[model samples]
Target: MVYPEQQLSERQRYYNAKEIAQYYRSRPWVVIWRALTIVWLFARFVLGLKLDEWFNRAELNKFKRAGQLRQILTDLGPTFIKVGQALSTRPDLVRKDFLEELIKLQDQLPPFDNALAFSIIEEELGRTVATMYRQISPDPIAAASLGQVYHAFLTTGEEVAVKVQRPNLLVSIKLDLYLMRWAAGWLSPWLPLNLGHDLTLIVDEFGTKLFEEIDYINEGRNAEKFAKNFRDDPTVKVPLIYWQYTSTRVITLEWIHGLKLTDTERIRAAGLETDAVIKTGVISGLRQLLEHGFFHADPHPGNLFALADGRMAYIDFGMMDQLAQPTKEAIASAVVHLINRDYVELAAIFVELGFLTPDTDIMPIVPAIESVLGEAIGESVGEFNFRTITDKFSELMYDYPFRVPAKFALIIRSLVTQEGLALTLNPNFKIVEVSYPYVARRLLTGESPEMRRRLIDVLFKNGKLRWDRLENMIAIARSDQQFDLLPTAQLGLQYLLSEEGKFLRRQLLLALTEDDRLHTQELQRLWDLVKDDLEPKRLFDVALSSLRVVSTEGIAAILPTANTINSL
Candidate 1:
């Protein structure tokens, strides 16, 4: 259980401390201003008080608050921008204004001089710009807070996009991280909410990723890994990396010319099917999560494209996550439990997934899940909204001893962004309907014996099979891929022939299905075999006498259904 410490070079450690010290020295006012802002916001929103002198009247309005926050983050620079981007995904923590505006928060800034970008590329790659590309665009095709991209063609006639990191990105990011750590420490004592634990973890995770992202070589590796994962998938396209031209500061990738996924009108104008595009996106997302264990953490519209030939292309790979298989299976199980309205199983799943700490009592979590699932289970299949259910469930987590895992947050963000874009393209798009195929396929074909047993538990009641659950599984399986139900049916038939199975089946059908009568002529044949056996009849009578709960309608349903049991 021992963990190894990370090894950092002396220079790196020095710079880390230096940046922290410089942050406070140069920008104490920034920290103070934000601290005051937090206090004012908590008092105004949480406590319902108006501080007329500290804030503008117009900015205090709920509708204007998101814009105000976005402007504040943008003005604060790269570190806060990253913080805002991370906060955008946490609907449980932030208000609607903050969530909406932060989702639209762009990191775009005016491009640095083309000459400086060219010089850096040449310097990083150890070659002149002329030798790297036959022709390279002087103007940047796109510019963001950290880097700028230019279109270029290699001498071999390969068109590519050259991304050059900003000159002082590392230094600026370092200083910003320092400022963030300082601010977090400064605000820790007086914060109204018990967010200190979650806040510290978030900043730590962000810093870990921030350093990883600044290394262009790591980004190249991420793209290559994604490409390897989807090498055979024609629907998903990952940009090819030119490793020979890539370095810590500059990366060269195959240029893709396509419309952004958000541009629904243009995608339609180009004769692309919106439904197919969304389906492909969802399928690819599932494969990354369930099959490969690696996923594109950032799937916003800006990083996705709809190609001319109707394929989906993903660009930025700086943000990616590796989900462990156990977590993935738990998620699949949770989905099935939710669909079946099994609140107890779903509550245990939350504990199993590490959202709840081990040894913590689950009794308290069960009611919250039940309240949400009760409202949800009544809805028809098409009425299911994944985001709405997820948001509601998240709202419940705010008061519980639940920790939001980083990968879980990224998964939510990716789906929310994709779902929003899909709805924009087609108003009637339902995420669960499209995603159900994946979950269903996994449950039926999954390798876990325990999971398979759970499936049987859902299908069986008091050792009697409920044919409807069987039929639903068959239907869901048939919708996506071919399934051979003969084995499952044979297993059920084996149980039907056993002595205990008869009583269980009789009790289950009578108690569960009210009006759905079953034909049970086959039961007469089985009884005819036992009629001659006086000893077995006596045993049955004894067992029947021990029953304390019995319903007349249940017995009536069983009689008719038992007579009608002529087929599997």
Candidate 2:
């Protein structure tokens, strides 16, 4: 049965294994030609490298070979370009020299014909450029694998960026995916792959995301949702989408005027602080992972800009991902487990997060994880960074049954690219230094039940309060300027009197009466740690103000304990 173009496009939004297989099966010539071309390129590069190694010849230097690899991917078109971009962030999979070259794939690509691009825009929007736009660039301002963007102004004098998708993107992407899936099936058996999962699943995941990215309608919606997630955040910016001019092949968004985040010289010339820009990127990135659970999966330097007013602007929302609530909580818990040096729980978390099968024995893997992560975290958390941990974990993946879950592929890419961006601005920048403070503040002040439970887990163990852990968490959280002391205290008091905190209350009472006497030493230690921040005048004002929000019964429930503490 024949289908309309719109219906076909809608049906193609997701990966359909059966449909893809059948479609490619009917195009044997196309597959054969593409396969031959790809194999030829690989043979040329691999043979050259082998010869260089055998003869100790400096003919093809690492930089030259890396450039050739980039050229091959670019020549092969968008699909291979996307794969190159993914590899650019994986230090374990690609060499540093090649990675440096592959990084250019993020934004540096040859533009398609300008005339064809304009025609596509006119065809999609159902109007000539003269009528639709007051002024538009004669050539694309920027060209990417899937699309090229033009700076344009609407007839009503509003500035916008017109992004026109490459000609026949779907056809090219489909053919490439089919060939990739086919190649993976044959290559997996011979390749020295230690990944615990099937290779095709990774291909399928990439295919699905690629399809979504090529859909401008979907990307526009992603932008709107991302903007809403950060509506209250003053430090972040998202371009406004113009739905009237957007389609599956075309998207017009507000033109963002800012400096590329990696351009340190220009940023400094504009009187912007590079350090503050890095902090903004890290904190906003954390919120996306831990709080909203929706994040931009690709945050290369080209996508993030530093605004004139110091806000960080995020553009190009084509690649975004969402985490299930359980997944999100498990990740936050995993961070706490790592900080506490609880490798056993950390191993279990890896299993839960799909890095290992549930049936796999974690006992042997626990020490391996600890040795790798412990060395990466060395002396203090400040020294820890994603790149180091990722490199270490890559080694573990070879030795253990660890695998990169298909779901977490983009998450890793997003994080590594973000760190790469930061490093370009400040060589001394460590992501953990900025990220830990945000995580600590969330654990301390997060109002969700899941976060509250995590907080309790961090603060207590074996039915006793760990005063030292609490003090450490507070000290770390205090480093974040956004951490509000009074609100957190009031939230803590309210939770202590609520139904959810019954377990915590019982645990507290048990610790207090364990020796058949008041255990005031821990309490005194806590008070001393926070005395300066919670001085008498501030405490009194907070108490008086908190009364309006706290129910009388809730206050009554905690009054006896308060009186006992006062007497002490």
Q: lDDT values of the candidates?
A: 0.68, 0.83
Query: How well does candidate 1 score on lDDT at residue 134?
Result: 95
> How would you encode candidate 1's per-residue C-alpha lDDT over 1-568 as one tens digit per residue?
1112223344542334445566567877865666576556545544322443356554466666566667666655666666666566445457766677776654344578999999988878789999879999989988765688999999999999999988777666665676566666777555443334455555556666667777777788899889999999888889989888887778899999988775778899999999988888888887787778898877766678889888889988887888887777777777777876778778788888866777879897788878876676557655666767766776665566666664576777777767766765676888777777677766665445444455555556555665555556556655653344333333433333334345446555553443465435434543443344336555455445423233444334345556745432
Clashing pairs in 1: 518-561, 519-563, 519-564, 519-565, 520-562, 520-563, 520-564, 520-565, 521-563, 521-564
Cα lDDT tens digits for candidate 2, 1-568: 2211332355677778679889889889989999999999999999989988988864558899999999999999999998787677565568888988897887778999999999998888888989989999999998888999999999989999999999878888888999988877888776444563567887887888888899888888899899999999999999998877877788999999999876799999999888999999999998899999999987877788999899999998888999987787788778777876888888988999998889999998898999989888888878878888887888886678777888798788888888888877887788888887778778888669988887787777777777677777787777777777778887876677766666777678767766677768877877876787887888888777767677778667766766655664
Each prediction's RMSD to truth: 11.5, 3.4
> In model 2, which regions exceed 4 Å deviation?
1-8, 53-62, 89-100, 187-194, 513-519, 556-568
lDDT for model 2 comes to 0.83
Relative to the true structure, candidate 1 has a C-alpha RMSD (angstroms) of 11.5
Best by lDDT: 2
Q: Model 1, which residues run further than 4 Å from truth?
A: 1-72, 83-108, 179-196, 376-378, 447-467, 481-568
TM-score of each: 0.72, 0.93
